[model samples]
Target: MLIKKIKRRIYNLFHPIQGELWCLHRVLNEKSVFDENKDLEISPDYLETKIKHYKANNFDFISIDDVYSKRLSEFRYCWQKKFINITFDDGFEDIYNNAYPILKKYNIPFTIYLSTDFVDRKPLIWWLVLERIVLTKENVVLSSGVIYTCPDIISKRSVFKQLCDLIYNEPDNPADTFRRLFSNYVSYFEEKTANTLTWEQILEMCDSGFCTIGSHTVTHPVLTRQQENEVRREIEESKRIIEKKLQQEVLHFSYPYSFWNEQVQDIVLESGYKTAAMGYGGSCRYNKDNVYKLPRVYLVEEST
Candidate 1:
């Protein structure tokens, strides 16, 4: 392990990454061990540790706009100055409650990609509902007559992953499919508590000057599976809604679930977004051609 670590350090020293755009989902205190989306979250302590580590390592913390400008600049004077930008997807209220304070402490500039419908209290956040059902009920019987029995944390996690795969890969509308599957158990739409960031919270973040708003589509649909018009509407209308709500031109976007094709890419370009982030791919290299498809590393607890 020591040898491998030394080798990696040497390799990285010679071939440093241009920038790292971290894609984070939620920053909150952990809940149940059986939480299916546990991987999507990291504790506030972990987030602070990451920020401190990067700062100690000489990584220049910057915004997505800085990323765009640096990548576009033809002159290369400071190749050794590595940069990292942080961004959150889905506009979760946990960010405002948990991550915001830590980020503010460090004076970090981050971006939040908002799905308008989520903020609008729409039933699009089906995954959280699905988790609640699995945890509360020992046996869940889908409307399709398929039954999942999650008697323990291990089984609960298994069931959640299985159902989540089905939801994401569902040929029909995934959100609608979630409702149809759980129609008998509970109504997916009416959450008594707000889970997403409100426009008020968003406005406050905007005022902070440390937060940048980006579009994550109106309903956070898998664009590749959607109809051409639906895809266009999801990409274009989301930009419009966010721009109007924030009263600022939304220049950046992120694919819902990182599911996109060339057609989806074209729509983002046509929609006038300067850049779009995706779920996977490691540190971003300065590439002018990949402006629309800027890759990001998901900053889970395991991320370095």
Candidate 2:
């Protein structure tokens, strides 16, 4: 791991990534490698390390809107320096708490794609509930009639992963099964108190000029699993809500769970988002080439 970090630093210095859109999930002060969704998180200090690294390498911290407006050649004028667009997914409160300060300190521009319901006092993220369910319960009897006995944290992690994959791959509405699991283990009142970023915090960020807010859909559903009308409503309503609250044009959209199809792309475009971000790993060569489905490399503590 140390060697990989060294190599990456070397590459950042020697072989700078040009026009990279880096996607991050949550940033907290915790350094433990084992935690709920550890792979999706980085310590606040580690986030600063990355920010400093990019700064030292002369990377321009660009926003999603900037990418949409500028041509690749016209924008990336620096022959040696690279340009990066930093984005955070899911709108975790930690992003407002831990990350916003680090980013504010560096004066780096960034965007957050919000799962509106996650923030808007509605249903909380089911996956987090799933994680809690697996960790706390010694044994689980799933609706499928399979019994999982997680005797330790290791076993819990393994079982949690299997169940998560199973939920995602199932042919039915995964939300229904996830709710069933949540109720079986976690309290419905917990759903009411899933305090994500509040409207005031989001407004402050938008007013800061360093942050741009984008839509991450209403309920953060896997769009492919829903019907066309449902998907359209998900894409449209989220953007509408942000625009209404912020009183500014919300111009970017991101796929919830990095799940996007042709239908999803068409809806995002039709809904007036100028550019949208998607997951998995790669750099965008040109903005116009992938305005709707921009590729991003997810930043994690351990390099692969």
TM-scores, one per candidate: 0.89, 0.87
lDDT of 1 by residue, 1-304 (tens): 9999999877665544687889998887754454447678898999999999999988888888887876444334344667788999988898999999999999999999999887847445777778778878889899988899999978888998899888877787688889878887665457542378889999998899899999999888878888899999998898888888888999999998898789999989998999998988877754333877888888767533
lDDT of 1 at 190: 73
Q: Give the worst 10-residue stretch by lDDT in candidate 1.
A: 70-79
Q: Write the per-residue lDDT of candidate 2 for residues 1-304, one digit (tens) a residue.
A: 9999999776555433357788888887654324447777788888899889878887778877776676453534327556787899888888889999989988888999988887846565666667666766798777556788998988987888788877777766667767664455556327442348889899898899989999999888888888999999998999889889989988898897788789889989999988888876587653234678878888878743
TM-score between candidate 1 and the true structure: 0.89
Cα RMSD of predicted structure 2: 5.5
Scored against the true structure, residue 72 in model 2 reaches a CA lDDT of 50
TM-score computed on alpha carbons, candidate 2: 0.87
Candidate with top lDDT is 1
